[model samples]
Target chain A: MIAEGRIVIDLSRNGDVRLTSNRGADVARLLVGRDPREALDLLPRLFSLCGHAHVAAARVAVQEDVTEAEAHADTSRVLAETAREHLLRILTGWRVEGAGFELPSPPVMGLVKNMQAAVGDPAEERQVSALLAGYLETHVFGISPAAFLKLRDLAEFTNWLDGGPTLAKAYLCQIVAHGWQGLGAVSTQFLPALSGAQLQALMAEPSFTLRPEWHGQPHETGPLARQSRHPVVAALLELHGAGLMSRLVARLVDLAKIPTQMTTGESPVRGQPGVGVVETARGRLVHAARQEHGQLKDYQILAPTEWNFHPEGVAVQALAGLHAVTGRAEGAQALIEAIDPCVAFEVRAA
Target chain B: MCLAIPAEVVAITDDKQTATVSLEGVRKDISLALLTDVEPGDFVLIHVGYALNKISPDEAARTLALMAELEEVSS
Candidate 1:
């Protein structure tokens, strides 16, 4: 019978996991395996949020000696599903965490009312129910131009009984125009303006951006969760605007972009060492891995939360930026929230 | 890293194990596991689905306030 192998690991923010094996196994032997099933089970758990990434890496490490075509398609499907799940969690967070003000709106209030009713919170139920009615009334008369405009053309239509058609139509036009402008900004001003290759290169290096002091210092992550969606320095200079609202708007816009991408053939690349890097509502997230021999090996994930929530160094920069602009405790908290640091994923191991 | 952070309890359940805490504009559920007899508005260190310790709200406020004050002085 084959002896049981054990590998213990400690992880650093830079996607490096230190592994110590106690079964007289080299990297190759540990990865390739005598009993492939049992050997694969010994890999260390890395970040919980990026379990798919870790598994993919393991597959790569094992397949180093094999052909790429041998990689399992089922595994690729699982990884993509994991990525989708992660994205959904982020979107839910955006609605609940990033856009609390919008909650008072009718459509949102309806959802909240249902949730409260189901949860059996009488006071909350009353509050949400009342809010939902008020939202409907205001939306009908076009009193809330922004709210009316935001929902006018959506499939889930709400009849605002008091809203004037003329006003609602005008507001809708304005909202659509604003949305287009936001998209243009994202495509031309924001994304295209930055050199992807250069940014990726910067990521590969060790720097204060990733390793900052101050234990559990808050940083942001998520699709629309933070200012990371906007090029902070560039936005300050060009847009001359920086705050919670601006950051939230950017994320909502990003949400509008995702469904199309998901519907198209833009999912995570399977089997090969494909990395999905994005500036989430927080700062930045990188998912990279290698798949080999129908198993996962050598996975690495760098999440925005890791950079922002570092115990020491990089957090100072984020804090300094927030302090410079808002200069208040609430403002600092807002900035921290703007980063939306995901501590859950940071400390989790799969 | 998942985007979770430590927050102060603005209110607590009778049992003191669950609490309402605020982070940014959002408020959510937090478990009080690491500290004893936590009260309203006491800061706690939170990470990955758990509150690890009780942090002083005064300290958090002071640190943030100081950052703001320093930024003003510099600007």
Candidate 2:
């Protein structure tokens, strides 16, 4: 049997949390020497979550330019997938009430259907977007996505949080009631967007993917960093300082913005010499590919998890700061959830 | 990066809520909540104790061969 690596958080009796990543299998190495198109086709089969983002980055990495239609198709697919991913994580991954919620239910199944439709046909983009927006409005937000997106401050957020009986409200409420809004705050910087050539150069260094740093500092990425400048997220950063509350809320804010992102079609940053970067649900996903002797050679992937979960990155820094308080495991889990590692994770006694 | 490993469904529970999947020889119970109409012998991509989706046997074989190649190279 093959080992699909996962993150293990070992918490000592003294409330010091240690993080270990077993994701040592360099799967990207397999793509080397293969036809770029074949490699792209294998991406979705290899990665069940964020597969669209993977394919999009790989497409940009192997091709120097993307036409308007391709870009729109790419943006639509990724955004649709992102909406489904965030919803699944919040609904199924969050174990807020001690025992986690059961799955295969209507909401979860609905998301899976939409997720499949996302990777299917370009003409289905509008239909998928409408279904997703309707799902969020009726089930999670208790308000229209546009209305939720316009909430700009803590008061607005708190009112919305308390104004509904939605699952999103319940999870956020638990964090607030437990005063975990500020738990696991860190001073890690946000990763800056690098040009395709710049990113290609960075990946040339063997260790860049495992412990990526922007100008020698390990910066956080993903939704929180991406949404840091949003008015509501800005207010959140000011209040919580990149803690559990801000991270969770940032995910919500990002989800609420998906429909607009689909309709508007934000141009993705291009990568020259076959390097492509895209801001995925979890964070930025970078893929670098170059041809040698008429064949694809030297392919590398830098997933957002690498940046946030680096050995000396934000997750460890935040978890290590936990004091031996009551319910330390729950706090640690919540913090990890806020950071949202893309892989499976477990928290246990050291 | 999140990489999902493909496993064969050996036996499904009576409730149809979960399935017993075997990866090579390793066996585990995975939630079937995210999928429908899965049968024994079908290959599904397993991630974090959940079966993301079902795949054709040919597709599963190709993916596993690629993974095995990577493992050999790393070793």
Candidate 3:
């Protein structure tokens, strides 16, 4: 099997933090010179975490033309996948934060499996969205998605967090109790919406794929950046300034709105040397392909992990400022989770 | 960039909540918390110490061969 790389986070006693990743950026080179359709089919086998997103991006990148309906369907599938991903993270990953929090693994796993099973079938879009919304209502929010979305201020948010004992609530309450709401806050420049041509040009540079920066500045992406303008997240961001709380709440905001936000217009370049950009669970995922006579001459993928986990990127900047101590490891790990790398990670404190 | 390699389940624990999986002769135990109906000799995709799902053996073989090819290229 291809190497499933790991991220090593070392926290020193003097409050210094270093992040190292063995994640291979050259994995996409495997697609070079293959037929675009063949590469698209192979993507699911390659990327099991966000496999649907990868296939969707590669499909658009390789398509000579896209119909309105096809674009709408693709957008729907990606949204469903994103919601599934958020649910998995909230249910499974957050369970480690609270001693009393036990993951309801069976139902959560069942829901994710059902959602994944429907990913490639556009006819199952409505079913998938309904499944995700129902799971959120029963397992996560303990309220309807609509009601949760209407929560506009920090008071309402805290009231909701205090009311539930689910994994999401337990972990969030700890964040509040520890006063880690503002932990990891930093000056933020969100990645902006770019046209296909603009994105293609930027992605052509080799350094851009491994250590991407927009206009010489490290910009943040993913649910927090995408949903920062939402009323609930905006209220949190206004209070906390894009810290752990704001980031986690933004993921909820994004997941709650997925059923209603399926009409995103993806403007992929139409022919050879095509480029497709998609918003995934972690952040923006870009795929570029250059084909001659129906075979790819060049292929490249720029995943969100690279941008958020860049040597001088958002994750490092947030972790660097903290005073490394015994009790701070939990917050540091939570911060990394809020930033959300696609690979496995280890937190080593010394 | 989110590539997840599949591993072969060589043995199941007595409690049935975990399994020992093998990949290219390397062995490690993984939780079966996210999946059910897994058996020895099944190929499963793993992430963060959990087995995400089971895959067909043919698909498993194809992926392993491709991964070997990737190792050669990167090496």
Candidate 4:
């Protein structure tokens, strides 16, 4: 005898689960049979940016039936999310710098030059390199420094300082010297500041508070790597703050890291119900599912951008509220950027 | 589909298949699959791996400014 069924999963902040099933065979015949090992593989293509999150959730849903290691699943989800955020930030940074309007200085120019030299296409490299160099002399230095300063203010307010005054000083020196190698070293040095406990907590839930003294002001979100390594989070109360630069940097960084983190092996567990959640470039993203008899019974995703980018309505207010009060365009822009709304990622008009 | 954002074309590729664009401080590599006759410094709304349409940054700023003005008037 053969049987078939389909299940749909929906996710929201409310955390509700609903299931319905229909069987083609008689109850008596079905009771005599064993569970089937049907292959389900349409999950990964959902969102290119959050593919890891979906995979992690699917693994947890499948493993719930057999293993007592639910916590491990959660931990793995967090780590993957952190890694994803890091890569996104890097990619975003590369693209933004590549925009040909915001070079830091000569030192930064040299770095761009080196990248073009290594790119292997002479025509493309020459065009991009010259464009970037020209942009630095005109627009990049004109707007970005002020933008960076405003970002620094937002960072301070959110208690997520970008490496405090010391690292900022070193970063400035590298910028002055065009020492790309030194800049890379300085960036690597800051990674050790993230504690294991903080990473664990971030994976488990949303909103971790720091001490009042350390809170400073409202920081930003989005860039996970910049936020994680931002000096303010460490110096103030040992808590990571959220703000625009942090959020933007986190997503940009994650874009650069994704290609390196792709693993070629099957997940450890593949046939039980589980949950996966990660702090994406936006905020907290979660995926949960239920599996029965080796098939997907239910699946759902809660996107981080949904929480931050709520449209202007009663139940869902836009982040533009605070910006409205500040009356500073840069401040408002900074705040909005921090949300890192992936409207494209959330649209399911189809 | 993919996680991509809308950005203004600060520069265009010679073939126009790709463009350098910016959104806030974050920029991206956008494909010209969804729009026609795009040029430098024009805003384009982007989605997962595709450009959906051309947006006017000036118009966007004007709208936001109007919103701010309305709030001030009400206050």
Tens-place lDDT digits, model 1, residues A253-317:
34333323322324332322333344333444454333456554433345455544444323234
Best by lDDT: 2
Each prediction's Cα lDDT score? 0.37, 0.79, 0.78, 0.36
The top-ranked prediction according to DockQ is 3
Best by TM-score: 2
What candidate 4 keeps of the native contacts, as a fraction, is 0.13
| Candidate DockQ scores, in order | 0.09, 0.60, 0.63, 0.08
TM-score of 2: 0.92
The worst-scoring run of ten residues by lDDT in candidate 4 chain A lies at A181-190
A162-190: candidate 4 lDDT, tens digit per residue: 23332222222232333221111111111
Q: Over 4 Å off in model 1, which ranges?
A: A1-237, A268-284, A287-300, A306-315, A321-327, A344-350, B2-75
After superposition, the stretches of candidate 4 with alpha carbons farther than 4 Å from their true spots are A1-40, A63-231, A234-273, A310-333, A345-350, B1-13, B16-75
Candidate 2, lDDT over the whole model: 0.79
Which residue pairs collide in model 3, if any? none
Model 3 Cα lDDT, one tens digit per residue, A29-147: 78888888789778887877877778778878887766666665566656666776787788666754426655456655555456456655655655766666676787778887878
- Clash count per candidate: 48, 3, 0, 54
